[model samples]
Target: MRAFSGSRLAELCLVLLACWLCPGSALAETRVALVVGNGAYTSTAQLPNPSHDAEDVAASLKRSGFEVLQGINLRQAEMQDLTIRFARAASRADVAMFYYSGHAMQYNGVNYLMPIDAMLTDEADLKRFVRVDDIVNDLQQAKNLRILVLDSCRDNPLAETLKRSAGATRAASIGRGLSKVEAPRGTIVSFSTQSGQVAADGTGRNSPYTTAFLKHIEQPHEIGDVFRDISSDVYDSSGKTQLPELSLSIIGKFYLNGQVAMTVAPTAPQAAPQPDPCAAAEAHWKAAESIGNVSAFEDHLARFSSCSFANLAKARIEGLKQKTVLAPAADGARASGTKAFDGNYWDVTLNCPASGKAQGFTRALAATVTNGVFHAEGQNPGGSNRLEIDGQIPADGKTTLSARGTTGASAYTLNNLAPGSPYAFTIDAQFERSRGSGKRNEARACNLVFVKR
Candidate 1:
């Protein structure tokens, strides 16, 4: 080798040092994304912006070195297949992302993303739909970080016209917007707007949310900060009507545009800093509220121990227990032949027959009768467990009892199997009992039984 000057030797040494110090010398981790847009709906209004959103997002992700799988207007079967494939791809990825733009429904706090070919009726039959929970479960297999972005809070037209079948006692609460989601550690769930609110499809080619996302996603900043910038941009673009929310639990830094810095030497272990008691309590409280379950509340109380909202959480837990435990108990009473419908306590059990391609189903109701009005609480076999029914029981006993759904619940069509009227029941010794079933227009059969308590 030829001898070099002092300056050249120093320059060569500096270059070598830089190579050893930089993380770019090593291979970058892989980033994978699954993007789906379902705008073509068979039973509801077609969305105009979802497909465009997916395409634009995919292009941006590809530019940032993400292996993107983009799909448009996928049906239930196709959507399922795509998710399964995505799961396999994500299992080896360092960062896995899922972006969905479509119609979503929330029933009993569980969110379901509807496929393009889904014909959602009044009933909340989630067996065929892709649940958000299932998506989270699939993404949880990723080796590193996970990101879930949902821009599917558009106004749903199907929610208005969808009616629950007759003889079904409980109807699921069909809300307008998607509900809040609880994500696991190392995962972030971002929403186009706050929970229980709808988002606007902008006049431009891309939605306001997607437009903002595209603008900030490639910025050379921490990924969480990028989302914060996007949130601010969307909030302003939507005229303050929309507020994007991010539920983050990421542990380390994730840069979309560049390589992460490497720590050359290990640092000494230090005492962990104390967490702010109020802040920790609030975070737990918010999670419980989003989940809206008794177990969540109970866990919060157990962990926080002395939070300010501990009493309030306890109260909510008690109320949820009543709904969960008491309502099912009523159904159990009817099923086990311990309770019946009468003048004092009207327990009407209705079943719908399988008519014209529909399956047969049954519903049970337990109500307290006062005056001539019958106040009922019903539960469906495959639907909601908290259905409230209000009807009038005739004094003649020959007349049929017509009941309707109340409190944001769906109406039950008690169709009589025999000719004349749909309501067929008996007034035994002391109770008003109905012991016949009927069929509705749908493919399911309806049956009714009345017993006295």
Candidate 2:
């Protein structure tokens, strides 16, 4: 026989080791994978690493005994068809995986994967992209293990356009990268970087995350160990900037190299250790900070009332409340000199008393006037209710502030308007140096009190 090279000898040894450890195991377990790489975008900047990442990862999976379904620079329709076929193949597999490398984003707490042909100029255009939740549901059909790897978190130019077209309430919900997702039982979801943070496309042929992943995936270590190693490698290689993250709910031990036998007998499985509360709370705070909305901050406060960031969360809520917009100033007022209330912060309290078929509600909003412009926005925590106030303060300190927003719950609106119904009203009032008051003479009695803060 011809003499084998050093690398070839090592590969032969690994094959013999697998055979010696578990006979016929390679043929026993069925593995399937769906790999997609979408670059060459039509309306946005094209990525450079996804296609090479997919090709290399597919080759590696194939050598590891996976039946891989691979696609490159795929459009929306082509991607959907591949996903359908992959779902059918995964239904009969022992281990199934889905990997994508391209553009991805989150809106309204839902994650979306972008295709090459996508032109996401409006929020409604999101319907044309692929929802990550749908793909995860498809991956859940596998019998044993389900893995999802996304190396698509590079900076996306499409997100800015979507935000510009979305409503103020919905625009605040759009976020960077992918949101954190809870993995289903027996599944693991991995991202190139932590939630709300962008990942780097490497200077090499593949992304930093994918390059690190391909390095350790062929090792005979357990799956968790493999990911931990990948995370460490990425953290070190990316100058400590890109840290990989995973949501894992997998049970028992699994090795990619099919090294299943242990020298000792298996014992009862142990429960996973509890995560540190402060660390978890900080993670939640980071995600909320990225969104920069009152609802997101309020949600953080609701979950972590006593965490270290509780006061910070409250302050964020107040700041976001101050950023809302009222109606525009009249052209004559806009041309006037500096108004009396040019630099002032107002503590705005809105109280709507109970009326027939409508429940009562109260909110404290922080408003500010800069260069004679008065603008503020407020939203009900944990609900869809929103209030936008915008107008310019004239030299007389008297003007009508117009407010408009969609209703939340039916019980919270005047006359029990349906949720999501649009409504508008005006506040007629006058402001002094330190105190001001306004009243809405609508069907329901609502009053506003503004005190200089």
Candidate 3:
């Protein structure tokens, strides 16, 4: 055969990679992107870089095989129309991406992306802006992979003005930067900065976060890796102050440049086994334990819902909530002699007796108890099991406990019962918990013993 030229060989390699990555349907799927940049504001100080950033990103996306819809200096009505049109286009596409560069903020836990014409003088003015959730909800109707990139975390000088002009009611709602969002399945959301953090609009034509993203997005790498690279680049460029945040729930692998992943042949039969997700989940769970926050545990469960540690993560989250519930009372000066919930971890022993088609479940667990609520989880024969015991200590000295436990398909709920102590609670009901779609049923009894560690 004649020697192939270097460029010719590279082209052939790329074609082969495409075939491997897409199998037989690469040409059949469409990729669409919508880019919006709002810089020219009539009501506040004009943002100079967003329009340019959008244009550059639009061009870059077009080069990357996306049918790009780009708009600049969009008003509220124009923004709404564009999103509608974009969503329609995305409905027919295999991959949909939304890139927005502008001023955005959170008011009362709801995120609103600002338009060029927005004045936002009062809380009622929020109706004139575009809610980020609306766009997300509209895009959720799309068939395949969705990507949302927001470079809209600039601090608004107008927010303070609005707060000063409007009153405490509206002021309390206005907050710096965007709130965290839970991306739906098959979607990836990228924020220029962490939730509630402001992003720097660079001195140049683009924001620091967008600049780093543009630099590496065209490279032949997995999409996740591309974001990781963006985060690293921005952190370094911004003196480690402006770190990007990502919410990813992508079901399958996707490469930006359609590169085929390298695969090695297995050396033995056992080597071909699928990787255990529990390993990764447990590692993240351990990492989150050090942080000891609700979001940390919630993140683990979101990524690995079916993992072995899922119930434990859920219980941890509930335990944190219990602590939060009791914290306010302590801060408000509760009754004298009432001790606050101890912060120490507790070892839990649960006993769920078999009754009325439900199997017996018993396991040792670890958890944290706050006040009269105990949240714990453990692995059983079928899967992970969780137990939540809530007690209400009334002022009249009569205390009642409610316990709920779930394992696989079996669930047990014990209504108001006289519980002995905040450290331990038991349910010895006469009937078993209901099962199946519809039928009369009774809840089974459960015993939970907690020991501080």
Best-matching candidate per TM-score: 3
Better of 1 and 3 by TM-score: 3
Q: What's the lDDT of the predicted structure labeled candidate 2?
A: 0.78
lDDT of 3 at 378: 53
Ranking by lDDT: 2, 3, 1
Each model's C-alpha lDDT?
0.67, 0.78, 0.68
Return the TM-score for candidate 2, rounded to 2 decimals: 0.57
Off by more than 4 A, model 3: 1-28, 260-453
Pairs of colliding residues, candidate 2: 324-376, 324-377, 325-389, 326-389, 326-390, 327-390
Off by over 4 Å in 2: 1-27, 260-453
Local accuracy of candidate 1 as per-residue lDDT tens digits, 41-94? 887899888999999999989888788998999988999999999999988887
- Which regions of candidate 1 fall more than 4 Å away from where they truly are? 1-26, 122-125, 163-169, 259-453
- Residue 343, model 2: Cα distance from true site in angstroms: 23
Tens digits of lDDT, candidate 3, 55-154 = 9999888877788899999998999899889989988888889999988877655678888998866777888888877777666766778888999999
